[model samples]
Target chain A: MIMKQFRFEPLAQASYLIGCPRAKEAVIIDPIDDLGAETYVLEAADLGLTITGVFETHVHADYISCARELAEMNDVPHYLHESATDLVQYSFTPFKDGQVFEVGGVRIKTLHTPGHTPEHTSFLVTDTARTDEPWCVLTGDALFVGDVGRPDLLLGDQALDVMDEATRAETLYRSVKDRLFALPDHVEVYPCHYGGSTCGGVNMSGKAASTIAFEKRFNLAMRKDTPEAFAAFVKETAKPFPDDYARIKSYNLGLISKDAITEAAV
Target chain B: MKPTEVQDAVAKGAVVLDMRPPKPFAKEHVPGAVNFQFNRADLAERAEMSLPQDLTYIVHAEPDPIAKVAIGILSKAGFSVDGYLEGGLKQWKADGLPTEALPLLTVDELKDGLDRYHVVDTRESFEFRFGHVPGSTCLEWTEPWDQMEGLESEKPLALVCGDQVRSAYVASVMQRAKMDAALVFGGMVDWLERGYPVEKSPKKAKAPRI
Candidate 1:
């Protein structure tokens, strides 16, 4: 089994590849655009693995997602939460909460974790050969090592008023406490963002991974103890949204397409 | 790339991007130079979106590697980069050309001059609140476009920011608008870096989402 994390430091974004060498299969989580799927495909082949699927935790608002492009190139399923929309001209394997995907002896379970965006999901990985107990959870935007995802950005231009800020903040509160932290405190935590990311202010630690126990004890949002407190904390600590956030979100949802990438190639 | 060639390019209105931190840029920059300031949050996206593709741009950034990065990004985003400025603004100064800057005055110089000139800080509220040159007013960077009516008529004005580089950017607007504003070199950063006194205020200026 292999879990590799790649960081785009320019934007402070984190992406991952989890693979099973025995099964020669892999999955990518929360991939950003500009980083071509070919790069990952070639890397996987060198490691004796093939990309089996690509999953997104949510429709991101910061940068375009290359999930669709990557999945197309790999001839693998591109998965998103069932509630996510704007599929454009492509198809996806829409998933529901608690759905399980298996590759060899590793079981990947999806947990619908909404807050940053309504369709956000987290994936919990269990090595069934070792134990039914899970080993790690990829908490996308739902949780970071020292901070929870900021929720207010879901409204306004990005979603075109799909939902209000306060409402999503409350959802983020529930998503963190109920869905993500529900796993045992010792579960290894991996997120799609870390320090220097504009997602939050001050509290986000640059550490690669954290135990649920460590986050529970020290993560500012987790320590808030109530939904109201969590909501307030999130609102208070939200950094200015990332640059080109609305446009990037639109591109990710296919409201806009990568004419820029094509233009660059030309 | 020679000083005279740069002057000729400037005469032809070649876009000059001074990619230094705002304070250093403020401390010294070419008159009419555009300070992209490289450190401004979301700089890459903003430059990609706003820079004109048809016009040729010359870049001058510290740490030569960053200048290369700027040229790469600008050219990739369809900007027609003329070339990197040879030796940056330092060469311009050594060549005895007029490098525009707000008079780098001590506190006493600012006190004597603040009332004689329009003084403004170009940083957002959060940064301004941390500390600023005393007696300077907070003006959002886009105030020229949004709040021009409230601004005083173009006069001998002084522009300040956390770094001198930002003031140079604002100075570009003043140059285009025919407003007489000068860059306050060694802005708040230099003020603090030099252990000069700054007025403290208990407020948090949230950075605006650009």
Candidate 2:
């Protein structure tokens, strides 16, 4: 199995393609816009592989996701957390937490890691050819290289009350230490976002991957600070709410037709 | 000399010294005016380097009060400061001097025009990525100005970002360098809001990569 990560620098977002060369099967995670899908499909075709599944970690607010569009185009099943059905309008096979799915020899175990949003999930993928411990954990917006997703984006009816700086900070704290840190230290941590991402306040280095142990030691957002201090710190550093967030969210919920993708070389 | 005499000297190619911060100068000003930040301690050093003592000097500020103080400084520097721009830049702009737009570009514009123009993105890289005009080389505002010295001495340049202030500063810098440049009015937000085309980064480009 070969895994490649695509970093979308503008949005500070990352997507993944886990391919099993022997079986010619693959899966994509958290597709951001159409670029990820186009790149992954071209690369997979170049390597003689086929995409069987598309997984969306959650409805992202920062950028529009083309996961449903990509899945439909490729004739692949789209996977989402069962709880996400209410939040997302697209059709998908709802996988409950702890459910395991197989793509060739790779076994993926889904873990509910909701704080970034109520339906967020992380996938731990184990290669049968390798050890029982997963090779890498695909943590979407739920965890970043040096920070956790800010929970304030999903505050709908209680948008004002739940988004009080302190409440979101405490929620982020619980999501990281309680859910993500419990994984084995040796497991490679592949986060969905890096620095420059407005989704999380403190993304770390530009490098796409880090070890759970490495982040546990060097990630400032992971340090043992009091909840009060953490709240204050995040409040001070938090980005102003993105101007296009509501539009992006509505797009993610299938409330609007996907905009035509423009083709211009970067 | 009187203000009318100063205006007459300016018509004959005398220098109009705009002692305002870069921000106000970029918005609108006397067409050929030069700016020197009044608050900087190295004001003398910068003025000496950029300003030619041979030309008659006319001091100006956004409001008139600062112009009076600038005239005093120029006199102390041995400049035969003639007079000031009465009512300063505001008056000049109000009188219908040319004003430029500052805009962030769509990715498509960046791709099509990147080679033809000097592409300067003033926004931070993170902001650049959420979708920037393609082909734009990011020159972060915090980065040292000398790094951009390699750009040709003469080219039509465009400065882009999420807003006007930063790009306007960039345009002023290029203008000071005597380069042909303009601010992409309204910045990137304006471009997108108007439904202009923007290319996604190549790695993230799901659409056919042009």
Candidate 3:
């Protein structure tokens, strides 16, 4: 499997294109704005590959996502957790938590990692050609380089009532410890954001990727602590909310379609 | 010049004349300094309104080129332009001279004042639409200078913009026009970081309306 990581410097976001050479098939994770999608597609075409799936872990607040547009343009499936169906405005294939699928020889498993948002999911992909153990987990907003997603964004009476600020923080803790950490220490962790992002505070080392063991030891959000302490810590340092959050959320809820977005040059 | 020389001059009753634009002077300038605009055509009239004919004016700008222009203008006007601020206001500040408050709002302060103050964003119309202090009245920076009529000049008008420089200049202009106003100290970024309330202009749908 050949994995290509594209970093959008403005928001410090990372998107990925993972391809299986034997099958000439590929999948993209959390594609950013249309510019990002265009670059990814051009690169894939140059490599003589076809993208079969475009995945979104959650509705992003920092920048607009081009997942819907990329999927529609390429005539490929867009996948997200089933709960995200109501949250996202576009059409997509909804996978239940723990659902498994195979692309070429790679076995891709989806884990419902819901703390960042009600329907957040992370994919653990196993390269059968390399090893039975999963090689790397693509953690979207749920897990970042050093910090977990801020839970307060999902709060308020209108959104998911079950995932209150406190409950979301606790769920995030469990997602990091029980699910992500339960995997082998050697499993590499790839996250969507690094430090300097307004989404979360105090990211780990600002590196694009890390091992499970390294995060367990160094990630302040993942360090062994009481759920209450973790929640309090996150609450105290929660970053100033992004200025574009409400617009992004509404757009994700499908009130706005991809074609509705009018890109402007900054 | 050395710090001691500045101190000695102050001790000898040397006047500290701030030649920066009015907005910055209003935000926080040396307490006793009077404003003198370098670009104003009726500088003699403005000077006659502020300073006595016999006083030796020590002209100072934020830095050199501005100070030179101020000195040249005052000298031409037949006022005794004693000397210039060596490094301008910043250097004077670095030397620990007393400065006064212009009292500009950070984003947090603007948020806190959502219920009380009528914030006025003095940035350009394009920037105002991006984001501004919530409940602020948009007065484009290019708005005619005389349109400031009827508003209570003493009612603590808060001037806000993307940064301090423009607001400072505007404040100085306001002060010269004999109006009372204050500059928002750190500008919009500082205000937003402190979790202040910002109202997006209605024209820009991409930005948030706080």
State model 3's lDDT. 0.70
Q: Write the per-residue lDDT of candidate 3 for residues B1-210, one digit (tens) a residue.
A: 443465567567666676654444665776556554444355565565445567666766643544565577677778876677676556667888777655555556556665556566767788888887766776655444444322443246777776564565555556544556766766775677666666776673221111
Better of 1 and 2 by TM-score: 1
Q: What is the TM-score of chain B alone in each candidate?
A: 0.62, 0.52, 0.53
lDDT by residue for model 2 (B148-200), tens: 33345344677786755456555655565566766665568666775765655
DockQ of each: 0.01, 0.01, 0.01
Candidate lDDT values, in order: 0.72, 0.67, 0.70
Name the candidate that leads on lDDT. Answer: 1
TM-score to true structure, per model? 0.54, 0.52, 0.53
TM-score for candidate 1, residues paired by index: 0.54
CAPRI quality level assigned to candidate 1 from its DockQ score? incorrect
Candidate 1 per-residue C-alpha lDDT over A137-255 given as tens digits, one digit per residue, 9 for 90 to 100: 99988899899888877536543545677788888888888877789977999988888888765588888688888888889877887888888887788788887776677677776
Candidate 1 runs further than 4 Å off: A86-90, A155-161, A260-266, B1-210
DockQ, 0 to 1 scale, candidate 3: 0.01
